[model samples]
Target: MGTTVLEEVVRNYRGQPEKLIAALLALQRHYGYLPEPALRVISQELRVPLSKIYGVATFYAQFRLQPRGKHTVCVCLGTACHVRGSEQIFHQLRRELGIEAGETTTDGRFTLEVVSCVGACSMAPIMMIDEDLHGRLDADKALALLTQYRD
Candidate 1:
């Protein structure tokens, strides 16, 4: 991120340690992941420890240290989803995308992940592509939906 922009973000939350999470979140939004230089700037400018900053970043799943694909595919493995065959769907996606869970496709088009639940148990056996949820899916149906995001 540009120093000017980073400075502005620090200025917005200057002297407010409680807003550390918010500042980090804003940086993540801008850069797609928390860049080390940005974190250092935040630590120095905000007088917070670098270790503390990293602690918070690592504590939350929302923060990503590495670059991510343009899209994230989350397969639910909750009890209801498991019973409905989400595992098979997940395996199909893994084979088709050539990536295991927590891995991004070589083309960076998609990142595959497994989540415990998305709170849509009624729509069990669901997989989410970005923010859109596709439910009641079999292996074939899940693969079919991938066509829409292939590009």
Candidate 2:
């Protein structure tokens, strides 16, 4: 992890403390995850402490300390969705994506996440691609849905 991306991102923010989050986000986007080397680079570039950087990274659900895929698939595990077969949907996605929950595909094309709820119980067994919702999903439907993003 060189300092190039971190340095450029911090430079764009003019070293403002308020831009720390944004800078981290940009850095993460560039590198996929905030590795220790990158975090050290960021800390030095922004003149912020390593502890603070780690704190921010760990505090946010959106931040990942490990690599992630290009597209993230979130399946709802809320009571209603579970009752409606969200588990089967999750299993289908795992099989198709070839990765378990919280893991990214070997090709780095997709990541699977299981959330407690997506707040679309009426459309039980809902799954999300990025932020778009697909409701009333099952194994076949989920497989078809994922094919659209495979490329």
Estimate, for each residue in 6-56, the C-alpha lDDT of model 2 and write its tens digit.
668867875566677888889888887887887776677777888998898
Candidate 1: TM-score?
Answer: 0.87
**Looking at candidate 1, what is the lDDT of residue 22?**
90
Error of 2 at 128 (Å): 1.0
For model 2, the stretches where C-alpha displacement exceeds 4 angstroms are 1-5, 12-19, 29-32
* TM match of model 2 to true structure: 0.82
Q: Give the alpha carbon lDDT tens digit for every residue of 8-81 in model 1.
A: 88889887888899999999988889999999999987788999999999999999887788999999999999
Candidate that scores best on lDDT: 1
User: lDDT for every model?
Assistant: 0.92, 0.86
Report each candidate's C-alpha RMSD, comma-separated, in the order given: 2.3, 3.2
**Where does candidate 1 stray beyond 4 Å?**
1-4
Candidate 1: C-alpha RMSD to true structure equals 2.3
Clashing pairs in 1: none
- TM, every model: 0.87, 0.82
